[model samples]
Target: MTLIAERVRELTGARQPFVHATVVRAQAPTSAMPGDDAVILADGSIEGFVGGVCAETSVRAAALDTLRDGNTMLLRVLPDGAASFPDAPGAQVVVNPCLSGGAIEIFLRPMLPRPLIGVAGATTPIGAAVVTLAGFLDLEITEPMAYAGASAVVVAGLGRDDEQVIRAALDAGVPLISLVASRTRGAAVLDSLGLTAEERARVRPHAGIDIGARTHQEIALSVLAEIVRELRASSPEPVAAAPTRTAIDPICGMTVVIGEGTPHAVVDGVEHWFCCAGCRDRFVAAS
Candidate 1:
């Protein structure tokens, strides 16, 4: 496999979110050629070369934007005063004053991990139905032991260890906690757990939206629909912790995402972040 492909596999195995940036068009005098690629990790580190430091800076910022919106973007990086063609939706134009003279267009695609769901009673009909139906919807069905990492946890045992699983999900801070039970039984079970009012509110006792579901399969459909609703509301998993933040480069006036790998220099007890080391050096020299 290609090195970029291998890195993608490794990240996928680790369930780490990242953006794959590929240069689809490179104008004259550009350092990056068409097909040059790079992997932008969640931490804003670039794994490969798409362009020089200036172009990479713009790509890094745009890549992070794509990660936030869960959209693939075609980023057009042009030199100062260079007019770009009109862009369609999911396309952006960035003017980099530090560019040598040519324009570069890179495709930034965010690779997000599948939303994981934990079912408490995998062998039971309701739980098994969740697993089976999740397969069709491309959701990851994880074991109860891995509930801590799940986007949502469903206690489908119908009273079997319902309190234990519910408590575990609550403690884990899973985004969606559901119990597959009738209204009365679910309420009694939740009350018996002695959870706080807010904690009890977090658990969806009926588990699914009221869809007049009667059979096991129908009920499972409703429950999965509810899970899908929550997923849509949150816009997928692994997007929970990363917040988009950027600062303008003092010298070049380029916007740079504030990350561990970004170049920065402190002057007069005030720290300033830069898009590239060259800009940082210029700022330091002027300071």
Candidate 2:
């Protein structure tokens, strides 16, 4: 377990957090055989063996907490209903990792979120892929004028049919692209489109999966898996993410958060925040 902590520190980028679970005590007559230990990887895989099914489930949930809080906790579970925890922000969900005959206490901790996946090709399914994998939205490539949001661009078969897809995404400095095809086929497609060798080099071809992934569903799964792996490998620390709320300027329809030192107007019952001076002026006038 200590080695796992060192491993997290050693990796410059780790997307998922690692958690250590050590079973402290097991009852002699009961199901839990003492001294069991486990390590929960970023991808929700356990390395060591615990006691029974109940113990495993309880510990798995606790490990996820490590990812969110980036802290370590000692979880002590008694022979059912014997243990209880005090209320704290995101810290009350501990359960005794011991089941049956004895009680067990374990430590759980998480590392960081080092996952960023770049997806390309058509990009319509990219959104669905994002939902499926809990991944960072790298980019989406599609025909010209199509817009939503993407960390990078995902492209379809290359041609004049979709020149803007490449041009705009590139101009925006999207670092990764996941194209679907063989290397030769991809090169031919780019050549036909008059893409310079430099331009072509900027585009990543033949996404994370191999060429043989024939079905759309299978391809999506494969690509998603690759993205998750990449994110895990790239991130040095995986931290739990929390929702952020921006103060909305009632007078101007602008949103701002605390860190953003934007001009604000107190609108009687509400305090409004703005992105710039002009918006603040307009807001004051409207009010």
Candidate 3:
């Protein structure tokens, strides 16, 4: 596999969010060619090259935006005063004064991890049903040992180790904790756990939407539906994303993402960011 492909695989395995940028169109004088691709990481670092620094600046900014909204975007980077292509709705256009004399178009696609869930008793009928249904819905399954990164945890062991899994889920701060038991048994088990009121409230005792489900399959379906509802009601982002800092390059007039990898300089105790070393050098020279 190519480096970018391997990197994508690694990121996916690690559950890291990133943007895949592919050069779709290139004009004369542009260094990047069609089919060239790069991976823009969460920290605004580019693993591969799609264009020169000016074009990269635009791509990075747009890539971060796509990561935030979980949307795909077509980015058009053209030199100042260059006539643009036929306007495409939802496409972002950026003019880079530092571009030598060409334009490049890149497609940015965000790759986010699937929501993971933990199941206590995978061998039981209801637990197995939940796993199968969750797999069909593309939700990843985890064990109690991996609950730290789980979005939800369901104890379908029917009192067998249910308390242990539920307690672990609560301790992990999982968003959703479910116990597959009747109201009376569930309440008793919860009360015996010696948990705080808030912690007990976090668990949904008769776990499942009130659909009068009798069979294991029906109960599993209801439980999955409840989990989906809870997930949708919470924040769309899997985690709270750190805010991005950006600045305009004084010489090139291009917006640059401010990060450890970005070129920057300090003048008169004021820090100024630049798209590339050349822009930073020019700014320092003029100052």
TM-score of each: 0.84, 0.34, 0.93
Q: Kindly indicate the candidate among 1 and 2 with the higher lDDT.
A: 1
Q: Output the better candidate (1/2) by TM-score.
A: 1
State the lDDT at 42 in candidate 3. Answer: 79
Tell me how far the alpha carbon of residue 208 in candidate 3 is from the true structure, in angstroms, after superposition: 1.2
Tens-place lDDT per residue, model 3, 12-94, is 89889999999999888899999999999878889998998778888888888888888899999989998887777887888
The C-alpha stretches of model 1 lying farther than 4 A from their native spots are 83-90, 234-252, 258-287
Q: Compute the lDDT of residue 206 as modeled in candidate 3.
A: 86
State, as a TM-score between 0 and 1, how close model 1 is to the true structure. 0.84
For candidate 3, the 10 contiguous residues with the lowest summed lDDT are 234-243
Cα lDDT tens digits, model 1, 1-287, are 88998999999878888999999988878899999898998777899989998898898878877777788899999999876655657678889998988888899999988888989988899888888999998888876757777888888887788888888888887878889998899889978988888888778988998899988888889999998998788664345537768889988788878888788988999999997888899899988
Report the C-alpha lDDT of model 2 over 152-207, residue by residue, as the tens digit: 34454433334455665556555444555567866665566676666776565655
How far out, in Å, is residue 28 in model 2?
36
Model 2, CA-based lDDT: 0.52
